[model samples]
Target: MRAYIVPMARSLTVALAQYVPLNGPDEVEVLRSSAAEMCSAAPGLDLIVFPEIHLCGDGDDAPDTNEWLNAAAEPLAGPRQRALCRVAADLGVWLIPGSVPELGDDGRVYNTAIVVDRRGDLVAYYRKVFPWRPHETWAPGHDFTVFDIPGIGRGGLSICYDAWFPESTRSLAWMGAEFVVNVVKTTGSDRAQERILARANAITNQVFMLSVNAAGPVGAGGSLVSDPEGTVIADLPSDEPGLAIVEIDLDDVTRVRQHGTEGLNRMWSQMLPGDPLIDLPVYSGHIDPATWRPRGQS
Candidate 1:
C-alpha cells in the first residue's frame, strides 16, 4: 500500500474539557459554561475537545426513552450548533463540541460529532459508527471520516463505544490520520478499560489518541491523551470536572512510524492477497455446515 503524506505541524497544544452534563432546560447553558471554562484555561491551545452527548445529558437514567432522546436531537443548522460555532470563533480555537444526538433528514437520530474551525465554520463531522449495543437507541453511521487541521496535521473523530473496535482507529490511521479524538460518556467502571484501549490504539497505529470523557454520575470523567508511543501524557481526575492540556508534536507520529518495530508503514506495504481475515463464506450464507471447526477440536 502506498503511504500518503499529510502535512505535519511542529507542535500543537490541545485541551480536553472533562465536565458533568446537566439535564433539564439548563443543559445547553451548562455546556456553554464548560466551553467558556475550557477557553479560559487554554487560551492558546490549537484544539479543544468536549465530551460525547454534551448538549443533552447521556440518557442513562433519564425519563422517556425514545421520545426524550429524539426530542433532544437537532439538525446541524440548529441554534445549539450555531452557539457551538460561535464559541469556537469567539475563542479563536479549533473545537470538537463532541458528539450530539443529531436528528437526520430520514427522521432517525444519530450520534454525530461535529468539528469547527477557528472561524466557526463547520469543517467536518463523523457520526458514531458503533453505538453501545442493546442500550443505545441512536442509529449507527456507515462511513469513516477524517479531516485536516491547517497547522496541526490530520485528525479523525470517534464517539464513545467506537473505541472498543480497533478497526475504527486503524481505519483512520490507514487514511493518513495523524491523530484520533474519541469523545465519550461512560460510567466510572468502564473508564479504565477505555483508557487502556485508547493507549493501545495509539501505539498500534503510531498516532496520537485523545480520549475526552464526561464527568459526574452519568459519566466517568477519566479524560486522557496518549502519545504515539502509547504514553499517557495528560489525564484528568475521574470524579471531578476539570481540564487537561498537553502539547504534542505531529513529527512524533512520523518518528514512531519510521523507527518503531515492524513499523505501520512497513506492515501495510507487506500485506499479501489473503493477509486480511474478513468475512467467511459460512457467515455470508455461502457455506452449508461442518466446513470449519476449532483448530484442535476436530
Candidate 2:
C-alpha cells in the first residue's frame, strides 16, 4: 500500500528596517535601540534586515571614497560589531545588520555583510563580490555565501551592487538558497532599475528576493520583496523611514521549482545527465549537465 505524505509549511517572518542612520559615534547604539523597539512592536519576527552600510554613512556626500573608508572602516569582529550581536540575542531574532567596511587581515577594506543568529552568534558573513566599479573602493570578495535557518530554510546574502550581476543570485540559488537577502544603499536614480532587477532575480532563480534599502537622508529607499513567481508582495517606495513586516512561505520555492513557473517554464529541469556540457568562453568554464542541481543533491 502506498501512502501519501503531507508536506510541512516553511514560513518565515521578516522585518525590513528602512531607517536613516545617525552616522555618528552612537550609530551602533541607535541600531540596537531601534531594533529593540521594532521587536517590541512586531513580536515573533524570524529575521530583521537593514540596508547596506547601515553602520557607516552611505557615502553620497563624501568627496573621497578612500578617505571615507579610512575614517569608518573597522576590523572583522570589531568591538562595535560584537556589541551589535547582543541585539539579536536579546530580541531572540535573527539579524542582518547590513554591510560594513571591514578592515581585512590583508590590510585591505572589504564591504562585508554579517549574519547573526538568535543565540547572538555570528553565523556567516559575505563580502561584496561585485563592488560598484570606479566608484566603490572596497576590495571584492570571490565567493558566494548561503546560510541555513535551522528548520525554516536557507538564505543567500548579497550586497548592493552585487545584484547587478545575475550570476550572483544564480550561483546562490544553485547552492540551495530558498531566499536571498540583498541589502542596498542606492542614493542614485538607478533605484528604479534595481527594483526591476529584484523581481527578475526572484523569478529567474525561483527564490524569494528580499531587497532592502536604506531610507532617505541617506538612500533613495525603494526596497521591495518579490515572491518566487516574480510577484511584488510588499514595496516601500519612498525616502521616508519605515518598516515592512512580511511573512513568506519558503515551501513556495520548492513548489515553483518542482512545477513550472505559472505552469509554463521548468528552467531548472531542462538540464539532464545524458546531455553534453555547454561551453562558455567568457568565464572559461562549462556547465556540467550531470550536476547542475543545487548543492548536496545527486
Candidate 3:
C-alpha cells in the first residue's frame, strides 16, 4: 500500500455550525447570517459545516409525499446555491453548506451536498447514496466524490444516511481521503447512535470525521468532531444551535497508518494478497438455499 502524505500545513481549524431549523422565506438569510456570525466568532477557520437540508429545512412534520420533497428541491445552479457560494466568499472560508434537495435534470430529486472552496467556487457535489429507507423521497446517488483544496488536505463528502454504511467511508479512505465531512439531519432518539457510528468510522478508517447535525425540535443538534483515534475531540449541545471548533493535524492520518498496529490500509493489503477486491468475481451470483440455512430449518 502506498503511503499518503500531507503536503501543506500540518494542521487545520474546522468549525461545525449546529443550525436551528426554521421554515419560511427567511431561512436562507438566517443561515447566511448565522454563517457570518460563526466566521466572525472564529477567525481563520479553514472549513465550516452546516446541517442537512439546511436551506429547505428537514421535513420532520410534513406529509410523506414526493410532491412535498420535489416542491422543496432546487437546481444545482439555483439562487440558494449562489447565495451559499457568496457566503463562502464573504467569509473567506471553505464551506459545506449541508445537504440540499436537488432537482436533477432527470426530473428526480436527490439529496445532495455541495462543497464550496474558499474562493467561492463550487468544488464538488456528492449525492447521498443511501436515503433513510421507507421515509425519504429522494433518489440514491451512484457516485462517491473526494476532492482537494489547494491549501488544505483532501476531504470526502457524505450526507446523513450515507454514514450508516461502512463502505461509504471506506471508499473515501481508499481514494486517499484524509478527512470526511458528514452533514446530517437526525432526531433526538438517533443522536447517540450517530455519535457512536461517527467515532467508529473515524477509528476504523483512521481519518478525521466531522459530523454537523441540525438543531431545533426536529433535530438532535449533536454536532461533533472525531479524531483518527476515535476520540470525540469537540461537540456542540444537543438541544441548541452552536458552533464547535477544533484544530486537527492532517499529518496524523499518515502517522497513525505508519505506526499503528492494525491500520486499515495495512490490513487490507495483507488480506488481499494479489488481486483487488473489485477485480474478484465473488458474490455476483445467487447462492444455493440448501447450502446456508439455519440448523433447524428444513
Give one digit per residue, the lDDT tens place, for model 3 in 127-211: 8999998878689999898988765578899898888999898778767788899998887587888889998889887789999
Task: State how far residue 165 of model 3 sits from its true place (Å).
Answer: 0.7
What lDDT tens digits, residue by residue, belong to model 1 across residues 194-224? 8899999997777899999888767888888
Runs off by more than 4 Å, candidate 1 = 1-9, 24-26, 58-61, 261-298
Please rank every candidate by TM-score, starting with the best.
Answer: 2, 3, 1
TM-scores, all candidates, are 0.83, 0.95, 0.85
Candidate 2, residues 84-134, lDDT tens digits: the string is 788888889999999888888898889999999999999999999999988
Among the numbered candidates, top lDDT falls to 2
Question: Between the candidate structures 1 and 2, which one is better when assessed by lDDT?
Answer: 2
Candidate 1 TM-score versus the reference = 0.83
Residue 190 alpha-carbon offset, candidate 1, angstroms: 2.3
Considering summed lDDT, which 10 consecutive residues are worst modelled in model 1? 288-297
State in Å the error of residue 97, model 3.
1.0
Q: Judge candidate 1 at residue 210 and give its lDDT.
A: 93
What's the TM for model 3? Answer: 0.85
Question: Which residue pairs show backbone clashes in model 3?
Answer: none
